[model samples]
Target: MDFQLIFLSVPLIFIAYKLFNRLRFKLPPGPRPLPVFGNLYDIKPVLVRCFTEWSQQYGPIFSVYLGSHLNVVVNNAALAKEVLKDNDQQLANRNRTKTIEKFSKNGMDLIWSDYGPHYVKVRKLCTLELFSAKRLDALRPIREDEVTSMVESIFKDCSAPENKGKALMLREYLGMMAFLHITRLTFGKRFMNNEGIIDGQGQELKGILNDAIKLGTKKSLAEYLPWFRFLFKAENEALAEHDSRADHFTKKIMEEHTIARKKTGDTKNHFVDALLTLQKQYDLSQDTIIGLLWDMISAGMDTTTITVEWAMAELVRNPRVQKKIQEELDQVVGTERLMTESDISNLPYLQCVIKECFRMHPPTPLMLPHKANANVKIGGYDIPKGATVSVNVWALARDPAVWKDPLEFRPERFFEMDVDMKGTDYRLLPFGSGRRICPGAQLAINLVTSMVGHMLHNFTWTPPAGVRVEDIDMMEQPGTVTYMKTPLEAVPTPRLAAHLFRRVAVGNV
Candidate 1:
């Protein structure tokens, strides 16, 4: 009888708390949340789409309750600027979910850390040392070598007698290139051989990384319902296990780098080496260094690949766009040699194509959730302290009000308007805006541009034999990064000299 009474009183208490806050604050209008659960059932698997749908009904700036948590979603350029620019400092903190808390080690890393001195210090380190233009320029050969290796791999596959004219899985090649490039940049070595086979350590790291992603993405009821925490014992155990495994690999790598650095008396340009060399200088802790290293890996690994894959999908779907880019490539970088990163500036059409791809399919549709450090008013709506804010970049890109023929996949639109995606322009915020904008935005752009330019300049992409160009899938798979729903498969016919497809040696840059 006593237990039943306590159980019944819980809902009553929850309702009263919600009501008191509702009366005290002028919260933005939203769907009527049910007691206790608070719109938990209303949210869909694809969260960005659900938010956009609700925005259309409740207006651009609306509220949603994810189990008593007040979430404010902004769906247009104006609201975006308000949240990301005008109120950036007040809302610069990250909203840590159960998974994020586990993955980020309670905000020790750059991406997940709260806005504070630690965040400021790490951001400075990244800007002045890690992601500085000088450092990125020093790492150019790794980028070029990996891209060329991809071209060589693809050429071999397409040139084979049995595989001739057949659809090749572009994701495999692209994924490998992304993996190799990131690992090399971070660790100063490749985990896989030239034949694309993972070494022992590579296999172990790959398994741990895959498990981390799965565990990180898994939805925990405990996150939304605090009373249900005891039910997720196994989930917590899994996260802890992931943490242990990640620490093992990271520490092992650190040890190896430390020994090598002492022997050589010189630090390599790779992230691991840089972190070790700067560890004492920056007053970094072991946890912080590990966190920052994995932060770079987690942030950089898949984003470039996703962007390039989406761009290629569009290029395949629109042959005219493909032809125009190839024409520009030919004009700027002729058939005598492959396109290099230097030629990216001259190939204006390629840049436009990439920008259009970004506008249409920003790799991360929803910017990372920002937590309010203080009570703020955005778009005349009261955002209470601790409220989580999300900017729907996807919705903003597709809004008919902001873009003319927003649904059309035309690269030519960029030619008409000069929109900057590096945080200055609110309308095309692929990398977000203000203080929390991606630090690696330039590096990502350069790699993506180089990869796409080379692919188009080296080969002509088309849908498989039976698949029509129009029938190619453009739907996005739901995750933090919006990957293609159907992994892209295309037929490539070499457009350059065979020798141009050979892999280039990446001498020390």
Candidate 2:
């Protein structure tokens, strides 16, 4: 009888605590949460779309509960500024999930590190050393070479008589270029050749990346119900295996680099060489170095592909936009030569198109969840300490109140207003804002701009035969990174001089 009473009292006390907190704080308006489960069951898989729908009813600033965890979502530009700027430091912490903790090695890396001295040190390394303009300029040849290789491959496929007039998988070439470009930049060698044949080392790296994605997407009940984590041993084991594989692969590459450095007595231009060279100076741990290197691969590689693929899809769907870009490309960079990174500045329309793509289809629609370091007020509502805060970037970009004809795919909109995407402007934040804005924004911009410029300058993209421009689907796949629901395929007719389609060999650094 006493035991039964104790169990009943425990639940009663828990209920009272929850009620007291609710009455004490003026939380933002949101759908009523259920006991224990909260709003977890109500959420759709596509988080951005669901959040946007909720924001319509609850207003710009609202709250929701994912299980026991409270999440405050800010939807519009004004609230975005409040959370990202006004309360930047208080809300600068990262809300790490089980997978994120494993992959980031519990905040040993730059992306997932909590706000503090360690974060400050790593961020400084990134800004001052890893992604400096001088380094990017030195690596320009790799970027140009990869783009040219892609152009050469596409030209061959399109010009082949057997494949004439057939639609080509644009993602295939773009993915290859992104993969090779990132591998070379980080590891100092191309793991795969142009023929899509990968070496043994490439295979290991590819497997590790694929497994990492799988682990990230695979849901774990333990993530939501912390008390039940002890029962979910399988998920933890899988993450452990994934981490081990990554460590093995990265360490082997490091060993090879160390040996080569000793023989040559000179450091290479890749990230691995740089990190090893600067490791002692920065007092970075081995785990931190590995984490930073993988951070670059995971963050840099897929995002570049996703952006260019979206840009190409938009260009194919809008012939007028594509033609306009081509005209600009031809004017700035004639058909006699291939468009280079140096000529990107001369083409204003292309810049507008890239900006428009970022606005319409941001690579990460919901910027990685930001955590409130302390109880704070945003938009006059309480954001409790330790609450997960997210900015619905998708909704912010599509707000009709902010953008004119927000649904339309128009690059010319950027021409009317000069908006800075590098964190300053609240209206457009593809790279996010404040202290946590992506450090590699400039590198991503250069690569995307270069890839799009070359593709448009070399060929005209159109929907497959029998498929009208209106029929191309623009629906998004739901994930941390937004990809087109349907992989983009378009027919390419070569527009450049045949001789210019040849790939130029670039020296490996």
**Predicted structure 2: lDDT:** 0.90
For model 2, the run of ten residues with the poorest summed lDDT: 6-15
Go through the candidates in order and give the clash count of each: 0, 0
Q: Model 1: per-residue lDDT, tens digit, 148-240?
A: 999999999999999999999899999889988888888777887766788998888789879977886676788888777878999889888
Question: What C-alpha lDDT does candidate 1 achieve relative to the native structure?
Answer: 0.89
Q: C-alpha displacement of 394 in model 2, angstroms?
A: 1.2
Candidate 1 scores a C-alpha RMSD against the true structure in Å of 1.4
| Candidate 1 residue pairs that clash | none
In the range 198-223, model 2's lDDT, one tens digit per residue, is 99999989899999988887777788
**Stretches of model 1 off by over 4 angstroms after superposition:** 1-6, 507-509
Considering only N, C-alpha and C atoms within 3 Å, which residue pairs clash in candidate 2? none
